[model samples]
Target: MKIANQISMKEIAKLCDVSVATVSRVINNNGRFSEETRKKVLDTIEKYQYNTNTVAKALRMKKSNTIGIIVPDISNEFFSTIVHGVESFFFEKGFSTIICNTGKSKEKEKVYLKTLDSKMVDGLICISGQEEIEASLLSRNIPIVTMDRRPKMTNNLAIIESDHSQGGYLATKHLIEKGCKNIIILTKKNRLSPDIDRMEGYKEALTEYGIPFTLQSIVETTDHPKGNFEAAREAIRQELESGRTFDGVFATNDWIALGVVKALSDFGKKVPDDVKVVGFDDITIVKYIETPLTTIRHDVEKLAEVTSKLFYQLLTEKDVLIKQKHIKIPVELIARKTT
Candidate 1:
């Protein structure tokens, strides 16, 4: 007759001949109770096989207690660190997290965003590479926080990012100070603002230091690990074939930097001895390489924490004025064996 299924907390309370409050207190271990009453409550509960409705409790709170994070690539250590930060913060607040990797595709990003929205997540943290989604769509109903990549058209979205321009300037200036005359920079074409700004900073450093800037030194490639490695190898081969010498190289990201290091090794060119190298985003693997990389370090964890706080504030606080907030975290250069 499915007696256990038919039984409930109320039925247990009735069976124990105790008030609901006493039964609930004993069950939750909240209030003091006589040993006799506690025993009776436990026996009744076990006999009934009563289960609490956690879903109903969450519904009453009007929140799913979950935050959705959308990132470009999970395989990258940079994104993984950011996820750690988000998870740490949300877990402390008794909230759960869901991570989605979009593989830097705008179509996939859009699909994930819509899917997470349908799942009724309390808030969303997006790290997007594209700027096609409308600002109105982001600002209309839900709270969305952007990390690493900023939305191009929106001032209404909250953005947490590192100072890429400063990082670039520092990296180029460091190379220049180390007596690198002919420097080459490898980056992606039509990059995001951070990349563009970094390139501008690199150019400015060269101009400031009286080094002649050449467009021929700029190499653009598709933004992928394999593509970057091939580009780095090709650039070195071309330079050698043309009988040209470059004293230093700067890559926009750490993966690209690692690729350049491999290319240089293959070509019998020593790092910091023959050609100094600098990379952005101090990914973990760089530290353990044959030549510890000299790279720009961003506080990815702090960015995630701030992003989570912003989402929570937007969701919890009524009459919250959403502003175009650009929070720029600092970047530092870690001098390693490479430089």
Candidate 2:
């Protein structure tokens, strides 16, 4: 009786008098299909109430229409927004997502990968977690996409990342243009790809403008967005106590940038007049904040769209030479009150 209750895609296709692939396209709302055909299939689906357990169907057929997403911290607005973008695409394509939060722990990331592997997830979308272990997973023929960070191994991997170095260059260049000297930067201690590339861009800009770069000018935060407010506050407090002077500040991410703003406010300093600030990843909240942040903007939706298309192609197409190895999205500088 339980077996009889389970309906498959093939059954729907047969009932609708259409090819299984055509039915799949209609179900996923992909490609071109005649309106009459779409209505015919949807009506049949409505009549039979033919809801398939995608997981069980996938397991029986040796294909899981599901993917694993590993992120450093889901609470962070940047990562959360990106996850939303990825999920939206996958959901529209009749796939389920298993999201895991690692809290920036490599061990936790490894454990999650193992769990996902056992479940036979079709692919993985990793957002800036463990590198070495991820490379190992790729070696075992896992279809993986890395976002906001590059995987250590490039062979047969798809990377969706922003031009962080260009973003950093733009932010620092803006501060230099504002006639501000003695600029400081807030970043992560572990030096993830985003941090490392942004720092490089910052240094490049300073060098171009003939401003000397100092080691003391760079301060490391907790690398996690949740703790960054207090981290920035403390860093600023120490700098103030030690009488360090700076007229400009650049943050690796928007959260750290907001932290810098709050720290400056606590010190009774005025933005632009005392310390002009610029940030990376123009997350939504920054625009509505007390002082709208000046930031580098990259489209999360576009990144997800590209990633989803590539993943689908890899899953469907056996032609290895036709795939793109890397995708780097551009960044734009948004000038606002903070700058």
Candidate 3:
């Protein structure tokens, strides 16, 4: 006989002869559970007309089932992709995501942190940003996952990022193989992990090839609110006026590469014929640009997938964080017309 009244997960678990967690796994379509167990739980839930009151469940469990994401700029394709991937993963697991665009401001990041804390977010995901997150937030009982950004708290739950050092080395090495010497670096000035690692790789390649790393070989630009193009373009132009000669340029990002290309064009320089160029971040537009970019492809989707999986594991299995994990997702170098 079908039960007229609604029942709790405990009742469903008892009727299905399984644990409440198994019932929850079937309900959320998450975690591990046998197909036979799933069928039995569903059948029982249906027979009893079980109602899932998310609010009530959360109150009892002290889990809001909500996540917070902090990013430097949502407008940036890289940060946006990371946000989307994380949001999509959590949404599939019956959770809501609150994305905060900090505009690279430390003040805004702190404000957002306080807001997330007040809202009782179950977890937090931070993308690569310049500022360090406070130790208090990292010390919370909840899991914290960072992408390409290191938290001040050394023992934070997880840090998933691309292998930027390898990417930088590969980009530089490719330019070297293309017979381009006296290579220059066009990069942003933030000095973040990604930037530092990429530079490290670039230097490594130069060292192995018997090339000297000189201060004059580096040209730094800023991330203007609008874009980095104008800044990169202007910076390159200034470098040209200073009579700094280079047979190759390794831009840390594709947009900056575009600016570099435009700058070189203004000086009547031919790419590949006169100067070879390599860039990092194989964004979609790189393939369609006037000169296709030879660059490193950072796997945003894979980073998000790994970060979310690690977070969920930590959330469900409390003891999983016995050791801190810093996972680096591999990157690939895509050769194009630029090289």
Candidate 4:
């Protein structure tokens, strides 16, 4: 017996010639449905205006068909591109993405995690977080994908990242080939695992070229994004003030490279003529810059595409038995006039 003015899901299913399960799948988006079937069902619902309003109330408790993407900093070009890629991919598959900008804060991250759980988000994608996800989120079998970050514990999770070590090697090696014997490597604020690997590559290049990997050759920055540019500039200025001579600079990102260039110019040094510069993550501006920054290029779109595919695989492939799966996207060096 149905309640007053209540039309059953069975009625709607029969009207559209699809099983109740198909309607449920369409509602939740956890399962697949043909475009034709989806249109038919939606059209029928619109035509009839199922009693008790949209679809059936019983079907509302299932998957939200929404994904939460937690990024450390959305302002960064790298992360913004990543968010765009993931959002575009999921939007086409009947899924909506809820983007949470943590601003690289541990407390904010914790808040987003608990909030997502409260909202019953189907899955989560964490991008470049310094802190690990709370183990409580992992207790449930929630599908997750992270970029260049490994959460504390995991079950069904996928990791995607660029080849940082190789990029660092290529950048440093190119600088060395350009006759830069004394080179300074400017590390990014809040260095992730990939950055650590990049540092290793920098060291490798120095070792191969018989250049000593001394403390003077490395300048480490902290977690303040707003201060990164000024900080890099100050570091270089200090190095110059201390009579420390460096013929080249390898900034972890293009933004930092800008600071390095300005600092060199402040001391009346000519770029490439007196001090060559290279950076990581060849952002769009690198090409048109006055010096045409040489940088390591990473494919953000590919990273997003692969991450979305891996996430869907984790969501659908129940028997695959995934454990700590990691995927690294290759990187290339965009050789410009900076080197």
Q: Which ranking of candidates, highest lDDT first?
A: 3, 4, 2, 1
Query: Each model's TM-score?
Result: 0.76, 0.79, 0.80, 0.80
In model 2, which residue pairs have backbone atoms overlapping below 3 Å?
Answer: none
lDDT of 2: 0.80
Evaluate model 1: give its lDDT.
0.76
Residue pairs in candidate 1 whose N, alpha carbon or C atoms collide under 3 angstroms: none
Q: Which tens-of-lDDT digit does each residue in 235-294 have in candidate 2?
A: 777787788889999998887888888888988999978899998888889999879999
Kindly indicate the candidate among 2 and 3 with the higher lDDT: 3
lDDT of 4 by residue, 41-157 (tens): 666555565452333222344366778999988988899998998899889888878999998888888889877765557789999876477847432467888997866665667
Candidate-wise lDDT, in order = 0.76, 0.80, 0.81, 0.80
Off by over 4 Å in 2: 1-61, 135-140, 222-226
Error of 1 at 273 (Å): 2.2
**Which stretches of candidate 4 lie above 4 Å from their native place?**
1-62, 137-139, 222-225, 322-324
Q: Which model scores highest in TM-score?
A: 3
Task: Name the lDDT value of residue 95 in candidate 2.
Answer: 87
* Best prediction by lDDT: 3
lDDT of 2 at 112: 89
As for candidate 3, its clashing pairs are none
Query: What TM-score does prediction 3 earn?
Result: 0.80
- Per-residue error for 266 in candidate 1, Å, reads 2.3
